[model samples]
Target: MVGRKILDDKHGGKKHLYALNVQYARSEFLKRDDQVLAIRLQQEERLNARKKAAVDIDRARAQAGQDGEPYAEPDPDLDEDVPMDDIAGDNFGSKTIVIHVGSQNLRLGLATDALPKTVPMVIAKKAQRSEADDSEPRPKRIKLDDHAPSEEWFGDEFAKEYIAMAQDFKVSRRANKRRVLPNSRELVTKWNSTTPPETIPEHSDPLRIDWTELPANEKAAPDYIVGAAALRIPERSRPRYHLYWPVRHGWLNEKDYAGRNMLERDFFLILEDSIKHELGLTHRREWSQYSCVFVIPDLYEKVMVGMVLQEFLRDFGFQRVCFIQESLAATFGAGFGIACIVDIGAQKTSISCVEDGMIMEESRINMKYGGYDVTETFVKMMLFDRFHYADFNLMRRHDFLLAEELKGGFTTMSDENISVQMYDFHLRAHGQNTRKYTFKIYDEGVLAPMGYFRPAIFDHSDKLSGRHHLIPRSTDLYNGHPNDPLSKAQMAVISYVNQAIPSAVTAPSAQPVRPLATPVAPTPTKNRPLGIPSHLNGDNDPTPRSSPAASPPPDDGGTPHPTGDDLNGDEIGELKGAQPDTEIIDRTVPVMPLEQAILTSIHHASGMDERKRRDLLGSIMLIGGASKTPYLGQYLEMKLRAALPQYPKEILVAPPPRELDPAVLVWKGGSVFGKLRMTNDSWISPLEYDRLGSRILHYKCIWHW
Candidate 1:
């Protein structure tokens, strides 16, 4: 009664696995109008299938017999090597290009290259005259220009009182009270003192364009500036320019809020411009010579992928294109056959378990929180202890860079009882003269990164008073177009209802077990395959059909369809047609800790046996910039082991092999993957894409996506 039909994975499920016959699962008591026609069709399909199988067998036998054995006789030198010049399953080709575009950066290079060129994933475009007029650079905001003039804090009256009390209250360190404050040690970071402007020296300036303030002599700025330079464009110059981060929280940012046309343009332009500028492949002719290996996130929208590929093959003039999941690529890059890969990027954290290069669907968890969140946590924690620059805001470009620098330099995961001390870093803000600011932070440096395990810290960071939404879904065209499938009437299902019914059958009875081999007499339509529709039975049936959905049959139980006798004023309604489903999107804000997320993802992997699960537990691999916090891998391993005591294998969390930065591991894997011989047949060329459209992905992808 129980059976499973697993799709063959070798061919990426190109071989269709027909669904089980619904008639076999239906009750024999009820009857429908078209049962006879459906039964005949089903039988015809079965017979045709058998004939095809027999013919295939015969052809295989004839071919095998003609070919015979490779050697005429057994030889003692069987172990000797047979030299070959060219292997078919070698590198995809020398012209292969690997591109990995993340929210924060883009890695691109030829497969043969040793290291991929990294570029910041940001773009700045000059604003039109209507939008750019009357712009000015940001005024100095390091600290109070005149010392000891205004109140020391930047919040409300109650907040000021609480902070003043906490600073002098001498709260015990051991208590670790909720009101965490820094001690009144000698201030390394100056308060109430403003930064003195410093002049830029010649020969040291790389761009030599004076990024702090736009060219004093030039009439206008360039049309576009991307990568690190984009961030260097100061606030005063922003009215003349705008910056867009095309990707956020692991997807196209604000598809619903931002028009589809805008998203499409932003994504295409950013990638093309970045590639051209970084790789020095500026012309369409240059692009056409190379095939592209695009590394996509493990959990991604199919529509997004299709849109990206459509641009690459149809517009970008690439010779060929293929996509690989980030998790699988990371595995290849790390030389791991089975492991759980955790990626924490600037704005998203994704976890997936890859076993033998196949990413398990159940273990794919993409949460909307990552390194940026930690930066935000740092700002909030600093402001609590009377931060010198209390008017800080991330929306301001310079402020964000300052906070990011702090998070990168000071934030850590180690618990070695660091002594409380004052530290300072020079703030080289965009368009602003180099300035130095000082401040003292005790537990904040460590506790800020700890927010990864305790997301509650973020609950109060944003003053929206609640969680803010990142991206929205207005359109999803994963299957070519959004047009509805063939109407149910045209796609009527093969009827399964029995025409005959026993009128006086008892309410219920134990059913007898039927024999397996119940033979039936030969039918007249032997040549015509079972399940072939009359319209499609001709020798030259050229008419094409669209994808189908079956029409639901009228109720067959509760009250049989054929015996539609009016009940004696007792029955009024029946369950028949089901309501159609509503549109759904895959997105969730981060609330769970890294440890819980990894463990839950591994445990939820569908179809994974116990042995594989154990192997995954033991080989959990941590990647992403946030995961690089010192000693974070060991911390995660300890937490996972504590949760699963019965597990025999020692749970280990390994960073990228050879101590490579987790940030570039996935891109490295893509470079490695593009060179593999097995991927030769996987490349989807422009011709194939044009012929099949997005549907070609289902047939060519290495795994059953």
Candidate 2:
């Protein structure tokens, strides 16, 4: 069931919410032996669970001294806060805060609740950037006020006329040398207090917002007339700008207001002002505000990481911001038993081992190997294989089209569809062949990382083709450590198997095979096939039962299959004592069994070994992006089972949480650990580390969550 939901999400978006109580669902079936027995067991288990639950409810009611009542307390705190469920039951106190951050596509969600959830929000509704066209016709000149001319100012006319057109419109300028207008009373105070009476020309280069003096109009002009009046305004020595505030939602019925729009407007203005005042460098000068939220201003070509964070925090009004590795979040989210988070992202694959939900330093492992490498490999394969078949006539065309197509699809660079030209050089050069040749993105074979795994497909890009003049070290096949066994395994077997057979891998050998040493004759034992004596016929001659009808064994041929008598089949049943039938493993027991086995080994070992376990006494957690591999739990389960063969096999892996990023589980667990209402306890902080060094951070096992 865990694998099912994960696999579904990997393929499509619709299956994400399908929840299966894996442990409960799994217990009903017989342990991979008989379906009928499993069905009976399943029914019995369900009935038992229902009976237990009913008993538990009855016991709870009796213990509470209210045998029939569902609940006893009538206090407000006892009631579940329906409205505030998303943010710790929404008493809406002044202390309630939320923080969020996002990229161009996803707007992260944050609140005063447990942890934050990242929600996707497009920055603009159906808006996109295009290359500026220089050949377009120039607009006719217009003027704003009689003193200001239109030719000097170029922007939306609505921006200039909004104040005059609507009585509700309010215009605010940067109060001090700060280039941003105030959003709240506190910011306004900061602005007024920080302003210098005299303009400091040298310090205000990026912060300056020079405005052209506007003269009073002789007569009242129509709203459209302001468009023409702008023609006379002279361009200021520095870029001219305005902060326009337009309140739309809050102005309507107070009961109908969502409050989100106002919050965004208020926070955007505050952030914009801070950035402008501190960073400076202004070119595109106009910004619009709807209530309190500020919209991203025009002309900032690339999105900055800090700005993204700022926007999210403003939108959500969260106080604190914490950064957790994405892979860790995903790994934990996927229900990988180990706390380690393994993330194979678009650019790289990172691994960090966590213990007790905290990432451990020593166990962290990462590699540059990721989706990009796969794509490059795909490109090389295509050029060598595809172009060779075509005989190189369409070589140049193939290269261009492949690069453009791939870039467009993955990088979101171009919106237009790509077409490639291919020539059948094999056919046209000497008329040796007659078939035409063509190349397409969909047909170019490649592999890319999907979630924690990789799926092979076409590279779909022409840009990566063609030989580079400066050939670096990548030609050796392996990126680094050419002789590395793991590298070989990844390329030849693991990657191959993953692409060919997804979800699970079956072991190859059909026989119950172990590492066989040099051939040895079997010793005669008392346990014999049908209990027949070896020397039954007499003289003890080695050769006995050769059939006359059987064909003679061929010389220089492969090994022959053993007969039922030779295999000792008479002593074994059909369903048991054979390779495939010898073991039908419970998959979940293999991966995570090692953790408990290791822990149990430490617990039960002799004095020296027990002392060794003491070194890891404080805060053991699983970390690493790859720890979320679906089969990891099963793998560990087997190892643990083997390690602690004599102990009860009840060790369980951490279950994934219902909401928030899974990677944050360890961190959240750590947070929960630190924040417990204790009588007197020492909580470690970064400052304490600075003061007392690493010695302060160390603690005993009791400190662990």
Q: Which is the leading candidate under TM-score?
A: 1
Q: Which stretches of candidate 1 lie over 4 Å from their true place?
A: 1-93, 128-220, 255-258, 430-433, 459-590, 606-609, 646-649
lDDT of 2 by residue, 556-632 (tens): 12212221212122211111221111111101001111242234222322113323333332212333222333344
Q: TM-score of the candidate numbered 1?
A: 0.63
| Each prediction's TM-score versus the true structure | 0.63, 0.25
Runs of candidate 2 with Cα error greater than 4 angstroms are 1-88, 91-107, 110-318, 335-339, 385-437, 440-705
For model 1, how does the per-residue alpha-carbon lDDT over 74-147 read when each residue is reduced to its tens digit?
Answer: 12221222221112223443677888988777788877777788877777776643112232212112234346
What TM-score does candidate 2 reach?
Answer: 0.25
Task: Compute the lDDT of residue 420 as modeled in candidate 2.
Answer: 28
lDDT of 1 at 542: 16
